[model samples]
Target: MLHHRPAHTPVRPTPRRARTALVLAVAAAVAGLAACQAASSPPATTSVTPAKAPADRPDRGARDGEAAGHVPDGATVFDDALPALAHLDPALLAALQAAASDAERDGVTFFVNSAWRSAAYQDQLLREAVAQYGSAAEAARWVASADTSSHVTGDAVDLQQTGGSQWVADHGAAYGLCLVYANEPWHVELRPDAVDEGCPEPYADPSQDPRLQE
Candidate 1:
C-alpha cells in the first residue's frame, strides 16, 4: 500500500495523479494499520480523573461515543482546528490550533482523531493487532512498543474530518506540522524546520522512522 516514492517525489494536481495517490494512500493507511479511530483496538482502562488541560484550551467535557477507547471523553475536544485527543504535546497542540484557525478561513477544519495514549492502551492495542493479524512480526509493522510511540509522549496526532488530512498535507508545513508517514496520511508530527525550510521527505512507514527502530 505504501507506494515507495523516490526521495524528493513531487506532488502534482492532475486528476489521474490524484486518484493514484489517493488509492495508494488509502491502501497504505489500511495496510499500515494507522489512523486512530479507523483502526480500532481493545478498550483501555478508564480513569475517572483526567489531568488538567491548559487554561487556554476550550472548556469542554467528555462527549458520549468517541472511538479513542476507554480514555476520558474529556480527553477529546472540538476546537477551532484541534481534534479530540488527550494529552497532546503542548507545543504541537498550540501549533495545530493556530493552523486550524487559519484553515477555517479557507473552509477546512481539522479534527484530532487520536493523541497521547497510555502505555497500557498501546500494549493492549499491540496484543489485539497480533491476535487479529495472527503474528507478532506482522503486527509489529502496524504497532510500536509503548515507550517508542510518539502518542505516548504526546508528540503525535492522528486526524479526522473530511478535508483535514488533505489540507494539512498541502499547507501544514507552514505551521511546523509535517506528515510523518507516506502510508498514514493522518499521522502528523511537529517539524519546526518545516515552518521556514519546508517539510522534509516522508518515510514510508513507522519501520522507516529512525525514532522507532528501537
Candidate 2:
C-alpha cells in the first residue's frame, strides 16, 4: 500500500507585526542620514587671546645724563628747552647770547658743550675722574668738588672747540666773557670788568685756582 503526504500551507504576517517592521526600517534610515550629516560637518572653533607687548624703557646713559642737567649734543646757548643752558646765571647767559649774535655775522656759531650741572652730577664726575686718574690730586686738576664747581652754581659754561672757543677767545672780552682756565680753553665765565679792562690771566689749571684751593 502507498502512503499519502500532507500539502504545505504559506503563513502571512499579522497587521500589527507588519506595521512594527515598517516603522523599524524607517527609523534605521533616519538614523543613517543623521550620522552622515554629522560626519560631513566642520569642526567647532575655539577662541584664543593674543599676548601683550613689552613696555618701553629709555636708554640708561641718556636718561641719567638728561636727569643730571646734561644737554643734548650740538645744543646752543639759545636752547631754552634744556636746563643745562636755561639754568645758567642771568648775566652770563646775556653776555653769551650777545656775543653769539655778533659771532653769527662772522660765520662763527657758538655751541655749548656743557653748562649748568646738578651737584650730584658734579660729584659723580669727580668720582669718575679720581678713578681714571688714580688719585684725588690728579683728579682735582680736571674736576672740582661739587661745593666749589662753577658748573654746579650755573656760573660757568664749556663751549665746543670747533668754532666756539676760538670765536669767544677773539671777541669774548668785549662781551664780558673770559676763559678761566688755561688748560680748559672751552670754559668761560662772565666777568663784567672784562668788558672795560681785560680778562685776567687764567690759572694754569683748576689745581692752581685759588678758589678751588679753598
Candidate 3:
C-alpha cells in the first residue's frame, strides 16, 4: 500500500512535446490578435475634394439673353453660360486688341458684347429663341441658327459700335475681321477668306449645311 509507486521519477512531460504545444499556442494567439485588429480597423481612406478645372478649359457663353465674353479656363459649368473671355483666337485677338487700342488712341468708340462660345452654348441660345418666338422657323429668322454658328469657332465677336454698326463694319476689317452675316452686323469673324470661299454665307440663309453631315 504505502510503497511509493515504483520509485518513479516525476513523470516528466517530454521536452519536445511541450515545446510543440507552446509553439502551437503562440501561433493561435497571434492569429487571434490579427483577426481582432482587422475587425476594429476603419476603412483606409480619406475625404477627397473635387479637382479644379484646367486653365485651357472653355470659359465663354451668353449672359441675360445677350451675347457675353470669353470664358476663363477650368470652367465645368456646361449648363450655364460661361463667362466672357473664352472665345478669343490668339492671333486675331491680339490683332483686334491692337486695332481697338489704336481706336482708343484715335477716340473711336466700340463696345464688345460677345466673343467665343461652346457649341452647346450656341445650341441653348437657339432653343431659347425658339421658345420665345413660338416656332423654330420664326426663331431662325430672329436669332443665329445653331449649325452655322460662328460663335462656336471662338473666332467670332458680337460687338456694339460706339458710333454705329457701320463704324465697326468699316474699321473691323483693318484687323482682319468681317461681319459673317449681313443681317447681324454685330456678328464678326476673323477670316476674310470665308467670303471668297462662297461658303454659303450665313448672312442670307442659315439652314444646316449638307456638307456638315459628312
Candidate 4:
C-alpha cells in the first residue's frame, strides 16, 4: 500500500554549491589582485654617498707660508726640504755625480753649500732681512723675491768650485749648470735638460700678487 506513494527523491541544487564556490573564487581573485598591486607599488630607498676632503700637507712651513702670503703649493712642500743629491731624482743624481767627477778631473771641487729650504724658513729670512733693512723696499734689495728665489725651490743649489767663480763660469757648462742671476755668485742651476719645464720663470713681482704658473 505504501508503495502506491510516489517515489520522492530530495531535489537540491548542486548549482547552489557551485554558486557559493564561484563567489569564494572571485573573492580570492580580488584579494590576489590587491596583493599584486601592493607588491608592484614603488618603495622608497635611501642611498648614501660620502664626501671628499681637501688634501693635507705635512710641511708646517708650507702651511704657514701660505697663510703668511707665500705662493708655494702643497705638492711642492715635501720637495722643499729634501737634501741635495738625496732629494734629486736618481737619474739626475747620477748625472750630477758624473759632472762632479768631471769637475774633479778638471781640478775643480764642486761642493753643495745649500739646497732645500722650507717656506717658513724662507719667511723667517725675509722677516729678518726686513728687520735688518727696516723696510720691505730695503729688504727686497738684500733678499730675493720669494717666487723667483732658488732657495725657496729645491731645484736651486749653492755651489762653490775649488778654483773660483771665474773657473766655474768657464767650466760649469760641461755640468749643465749655470748662473742665472748676477747677484748670486755661489748659485748654480741645473742645465735646461735637467730643469723641469714646469719650473716658474722669473716669477711675478711681489708688490703685485699676480697669478703664477708652474
Candidate closest to the true structure, highest TM-score: 2
Query: What RMSD does each model have against the real structure?
Result: 38.6, 7.8, 12.2, 14.2
TM-score of 1: 0.61
Candidate 4 TM-score to native: 0.45
Q: Estimate each model's TM-score.
A: 0.61, 0.73, 0.50, 0.45
Model 2, runs deviating above 4 Å = 1-64
TM-score-based ranking: 2, 1, 3, 4
Question: CA lDDT, every prediction?
Answer: 0.74, 0.90, 0.59, 0.55
User: What does candidate 4's lDDT look like per residue over 1-214, in tens digits?
Assistant: 3558788899786798899999999999999999999899998789988875657637787566544334332222123243433454444345445656666676765555555455666667778989997997767654555565555665555555445344446665565555645555655566645234322232233332232212
lDDT of 3 at 60: 44
> What is the Cα root-mean-square deviation between model 1 and the actual structure?
38.6
Model 2 worst lDDT window (10 residues):
50-59
For model 2, how does the per-residue alpha-carbon lDDT over 129-167 read when each residue is reduced to its tens digit? 999999999999999999999999999999999798888
Q: Of the candidates shown, which would achieve the greatest lDDT relative to the real structure?
A: 2
Q: Please provide, for model 3 over 1-214, each residue's C-alpha lDDT reduced to its tens digit, 9 standing for 90 to 100.
A: 5766667577766799899999999999999999999999997898899999898765443343234434433332121234444346666566566556667666664456666666666777889989998998777754565466656666666666454345546665666666656566676567655334432345543434232221
Name the candidate, 3 or 4, with the larger TM-score value.
3
Estimate, for each residue in 82-166, the C-alpha lDDT of model 1 and write its tens digit: 2235367778888888888888899987766677677777788889989998997777667777978888777887777467878
As for candidate 4, its clashing pairs are none
User: Which stretches in model 3 have alpha-carbon errors above 4 Å?
Assistant: 1-83, 142-147, 192-202, 205-214
Each candidate's clash count: 1, 0, 10, 0
